[model samples]
Structures are given as C-alpha cells and as structure tokens.
Target: MSQFNLTINQKKYDVDVDPQMPLLWVIRDIIGLTGTKYGCGIAQCGACTIHFDGKAMRSCVLPISNVGDAKITTIEGLSDDGSHPTQVAWKEMDVPQCGYCQAGQIMAAVDLINKKPNPSDEDIHRGMTNVCRCGTYNRIKSAIKLAAEGGKS
Candidate 1:
C-alpha cells in the first residue's frame, strides 16, 4: 500500500492503497463515495464515470497510479443540494428510469455541455455515449438541452 493524496469534490483525501487498484474501488470502498458506481470493470460502460481535472473519465478502469495529481469530481461534487443545471434539468425532465446509470450519464452530460455550450443534436448524440438500460435517452437528451439552456426547464 502506498499513500496518495486525492482532491475529490474540493476536499482532500489521504489514502493508503495499492497503486494498481482501480479508482472506482478507491472512491467507493476507501473514500466511501458511492455515487460513482461499478458497472463494467472495463471502460466500455460509463457507469463509473467521474470528472478528472474537469474531463470525463471512467473510474472503473483508471488506476490510482494513473490519477497523479488531477482533481476528481463525482456526482456528489456537482452540487451540494442537487441544484446543478444538469441535476435540475434532469429532475425537471424526469430523466431516470432504473436510475442505475444516471450519475455517470449526468457527469458525461455536464462535460458535454462544457465542451459545447450550444450543443447540436448530433453533438449530444456523439458526446453522450453512456448507456442507460432504462432507455431514458429521450428524456436524457431533453435534460441535456434544458441544462444547456441554463436550466430554463
């Protein structure tokens, strides 16, 4: 085990873990932040998504050693009261069905908007590849649009 300093959600955490351990375990098990889920241990599924240095990253495949000094942001960090534009838009649009993938979806959505403030429909389709088993793609798109509009919904 090695000691590593992680800045997550604007808070600093010092943890002792194997450098090769996946970030998802470090966040969910060691840090006790469960919002970042475990879907596929690989990067194929977006359920383990988080923002690393303001970029969307799949935590499930990201090793602690690879994290380096980047600041991490999970869904919990997006807003304290769930009032972020994405969160608000999601609620307004009722975008979750099973809700298992919503956190990753939201993280990806926020990143998408950050990259393209006025994202076109193609932009949304290209940027958001997070899988939602509940088939909430329509609602997710609507929420993303609403969020891009500054939560006007």
Candidate 2:
C-alpha cells in the first residue's frame, strides 16, 4: 500500500492505500465521505462527480496517486451552511426525485456557475448532465436558472 496526501473537504489525509485505487474508494471506503455516490464505476455517469481544485471530475475513475496536492471537495463540503445559492435553489425549486445524482449534479452546476454565472438554458443544459431516474430535468434546469438568478435570496 502506498500513501497519498489528499486535501479533501478542507481536511488533509495521509491515506495508506493501493496507488491505483480510485479516489471514489478512498473517499467512500477509507475516509467515509458518503455524499459522493458511486454510480457507474466507469466515467460515463455523473454520479461520481466531485470538484478537484474547483473543477468537476469523475472520482470513480480518478486514481489516488493522481490527486497529489489537489483540493478535493464533495457535496458535504460544497458549502458550510448548505446555503450556497445552488443548494438553496435546489431546495427552493425542489429539484430531486430519487436524489441519487443530485450531489454530482450540484457539484457540476456549481462549477458551471463559478465559470459562468448567468448561463443560458443551452449552457445549463450543456453544462449539467446528471441522470435522474425520475426525469427531474425540468426542475433541475429551473433550479439552476433560479440559482443563477440568485435563488430568491
């Protein structure tokens, strides 16, 4: 087992694990950060998405060794008070059904907004792609738009 220094969720961890092990396993199994869900072990699904130094990436396929000194943020660490405009907008607009993919979706959306605050519907549609079994696309789009518009805050 190799040791990797991971800065995650505002904490530093020296994890002793297989170097090739995915960051998802490190987060879920080793560190026990359950908010980053595992969907497809491959990179096809967005459920495993998280922020790597403010950029959204699929944790399921990212190796522990690849993390290096990058700051990793999950759904739990996105905002301290859960009042990030996106989070508030999500709740206000009621954007989840099964809620399985919302975390990744939110993480990605936050990245989008960080890069471009007032994204158009096409931009929103292109930027966020979290698959919901309940087909919450309309609500998700609305929440993202509302969040972009400040979530009624």
Candidate 3:
C-alpha cells in the first residue's frame, strides 16, 4: 500500500491504498463519497463520470495512481446548495425517471456547458453520450438547453 493525497471537491484527503486501485473505488470506498456510481466498471458506461481538473472523466477505469494532482469533482461537488444551472434546469425540466444515471448525466452536462456554453441540439446529442436506461433523453436534452440558457424560468 502507498499513501496518496487527493483533493476532492475542494477537500483534501490522504489515503493509503494499492496503486492499481481504480479512482472510482478510491472515491467511493476509500474516501466514502458515493455520489459517483458504478455501471460497466469498464469505462464504456458514463455512470461513474466525474470532473478531473475540470474535464469529465470516467472514474471506474482510472487508476488512483494515475490521478496525480488533478482536482476531482464528483456530483456532490457540483453545488453546495444544489443550485448549479444544470441542477436547476434538471429540477425545472424534471429530467430523471429512475434517477440512476442523472448524476453522471449532470456531470457530463456540466462539462458540455463549460466547453460549449451555448451548445446546439446536435452538440448536445454529440457531447452527452452518458447512457440512461430510463430513456429520459428528451428531458435531459431540455435540461441541457435550459442550463445553457442560464436556467431562466
């Protein structure tokens, strides 16, 4: 086991773990942050999406040793009061059915908005590849548009 320092959601945590351990496990099991989910465990599914240095990344396949100094931001860190534009838009648009994939969806949406700011429908369709088995794509698209529009009523 080796000790590593991780800065997650602006909080710093030092942990002793195996180098081969995936960041997903570190975030969920070691650090005790369960907001990031486990889906395919292979990186095919975006269910474990999180921000690494402001870029959306799949945590399940990312080894903790590879994390280095990148700042990690999980869905829990998206907002202190759950008022992030994407979050507000999600609530206003009622984007989740089963809600299993919303966290990853929101995280991916945050990255999309940050990158595109005013993403077109095609841009959204191209950018958000997170799988939602509940098929809430319409609402997710609407929420992304709403968020891009600054979450206006």
Q: What overall lDDT goes with each candidate model?
A: 0.92, 0.88, 0.93
Model 1 worst lDDT run, 10 consecutive residues: 144-153
lDDT of 1 at 118: 80
lDDT of 2 by residue, 120-150 (tens): 9899888887677788989988888888888
- Ranking according to lDDT, highest score first: 3, 1, 2
lDDT at residue 82 of model 2 (Cα atoms): 87
| Model 1 TM-score (2 dp) | 0.97
Residue range 1-153, candidate 1, lDDT tens digits: 999999999999999999999999999999999999999898887999999999999999888999888999999999899989999999999999889999999999999999999888999999998899889999999999999999331
Order the candidate numbers by TM-score, best to worst: 1, 3, 2
> How many clashes (backbone atoms < 3 Å, residues ≥3 apart in a chain or on different chains) does model 2 have?
0
- Give me the displacement of residue 132 in model 2, in angstroms: 1.7
> Which residue pairs overlap in candidate 3's backbone?
none
lDDT, candidate 3, residue 132? Answer: 96
lDDT of 2: 0.88
